[model samples]
Target: MSKEENAIIARKLSKRFPRKVFPRLEYFDVLRDVSFSIKKGERVALIGSNGSGKTTLLKTMATIYLPDSGDLLINGYDVYKHAEKIASHTTLISPALDFQKKLTLRQTLRFFHSIQAPYGELDIALDFLKRMHMEYLLDKRLESFSEGQKAITRIAIGMMKNPDIFFLDEITTGLDVNRKEDLVDFLKENISSEQTIVMVDHDPLIVERICDSYILLSRGVVVKQGRAKDIGKELAYKYEVMVIMKDRPEFDEIVMLFPDQADDVLIDGHVVYFRAEDEDELYSIIERLRLNRETITKYVVSLVDLSNIYHALKPETINEIRTVEDEKGLPERTPTFDELQEIIRLFGIMIDTKSGVKIPPRKLP
Candidate 1:
């Protein structure tokens, strides 16, 4: 392919990390001969389970780490040989704690501008702050800002430089619903036809919403690459429906409202239905049911339901479903306790990785 046609290109790019404690410890392969090309103006999402090399690939594209083998080029600039030139046109928003705590938002931005452009281009910085709804917090010390505030500030700083390629590593962490929506709006508005964006997030929901394309990584390899909408459609075939109830009151009410549907309901678990149209109708029904101020706490329509998808997609994942014959000899399995725990954990991880929901670690007895 022509160099001018590609925004970023990786040809068999790979990375290896040496182990710390032994004379001959095995080198960990963080990335393995991954090759893909991103086009200008395309919004691509890199998704995987933890340790699947999404961050490593992004860092390599950002020229933070040189590939152990193969080649990576950003806008025709060799990532290894043209690190400085690539740095000029690429920006990476990592999770590293690098901001100055003592400096206020405005002061910090000014400092970054001095280093990045140095020619007095504070207008873009100011505009970004304004777009983030963070202009009012400009004078507040970075140390005093909340996690969400810090995240927004970092994003604003990254955008100020107007890099040709933007690599976002879960940049929406710690943001509230309103702030998240605002940031998404800003991204949609400012993304130019000449710029490229690559994002990594565990939550497919967020990825599906923002990205036009997706690359699914598993065990340091690209397992699937295609349009995001196509992947969603494939996942929908295997997903089970979930009806969440807050307590016994809501559960009882749900049963009373739809007795026939209740028979298939797994009570706090997910149910599989073959028809997408029925699922849509069920979602609407649930919403209307909640409109009456009924004691319904929460209702959700999951496309693939995380647990089922994880097990179906990842060979390493353990399946919890056991086949049993019903009264008519139809086979089914009740979702087990372990399955519920895994599903909840997977959901939490996806949310935290995508939105920075800091869930505390589970306590072990």
Candidate 2:
């Protein structure tokens, strides 16, 4: 497809933040020369481990964050130059979006609806809430509602704008079963064919069901890309065979036996995992182990899932994702997106914190 056919494009985009290294200041790169594109109306999933910059990349694409280097174009317009216009066309839903706990759901919806939509649009937003079965809780204080109720409320408020592009950052994580069903029903019925959705979700089942393609990120870089069914081939069959053995010898043997399907086979120390795409494939793998059960300590045939992908993307040497608890003095990384927004609200001014300098506003086209 041509460049004009794409909804969003990132070319060698890079972003970094300043960090204190005891005696001096150092820079930590969050995004490193990232490049990717999403066609208009396509549903795409951002897959990655912790601290892989998935959230940061999503924020950049939504124009909530800007690239320090390279170009990001949304609908053929430079995001850095037309940030506001691009952002207005997209709505991001995540756990970071919080409502006032003291207010009733009715009051909260009206308050944000007045800001994001016209008077008549309130009914449309209410319709979504009703579909989610959250209208009954409208008079209840937000603080008393369950996390699942809060989840749907966020989407309802976000949809008030009727954005063209939806950017979801792990929106389904904390939802209860009933609420999750409601959200799924909403996605299936409410979303239009022409609207685009970019999401960051850990559940491979949801990703495969909702997304057409996926971009896998690792340490702030695109490590892999493929069709959604390639999520360990979960669409064909839902079984995984994990054989416990020793050394690369078994790993090599399995690879040799299943040369064509080697990509579905993976080994990490004492465990060898086989991602079966079908029942025949699942039994074949188990049958192979049965033939050599004397040498095989044991093997298990369970449901195929996203664990292999996560293991593949696991950092080779990284210890762990640092958090606020990791810092004894100042934060290890820059303030989070919510923190920065709060700062801008209360302080009347905020800096990027990368260079400790105020950023000039971008001019609208």
Question: Which residue ranges in model 1 land beyond 4 Å of their true spot?
Answer: 118-121, 232-242, 246-365
Clashes of 1: 0
Q: lDDT for model 2, please.
A: 0.69
Compared with the true structure, what per-residue lDDT tens digits does model 2 show for residues 1-365?
Answer: 79888888888888877777668878777877788888888888888777889999988888878798989988778987998778677888988889899999999988987776442267757888888777789899999988777878888877777777889988887787676777777786777887789998877667656787878675675645556555443223366677777454464576666564576665666777666667887777777776667666878776534443444333231112222223444334434546544544343323343433121211111
Residue 51, candidate 2: Cα error in Å is 0.5
Candidate 1 local lDDT, 193-255, one digit each (tens):
788899986555556567888676755656456564554344423224444444454445555
- Report the number of backbone clashes for model 2: 0
Q: What C-alpha lDDT, on a 0 to 100 scale, does residue 216 get in candidate 1?
A: 61
True-structure RMSD for candidate 2? 13.4
Candidate 1 C-alpha RMSD relative to the actual structure: 10.7
In model 2, residue pairs whose N, Cα or C atoms come closer than 3 Å (at least 3 residues apart or on different chains), thus clashing, are none
Q: What lDDT score is found at residue 297 in candidate 2?
A: 80
RMSD of each: 10.7, 13.4
On the 0 to 100 scale, the lDDT of residue 182 in model 1 is 81
Candidate 2 TM-score, C-alpha based: 0.68
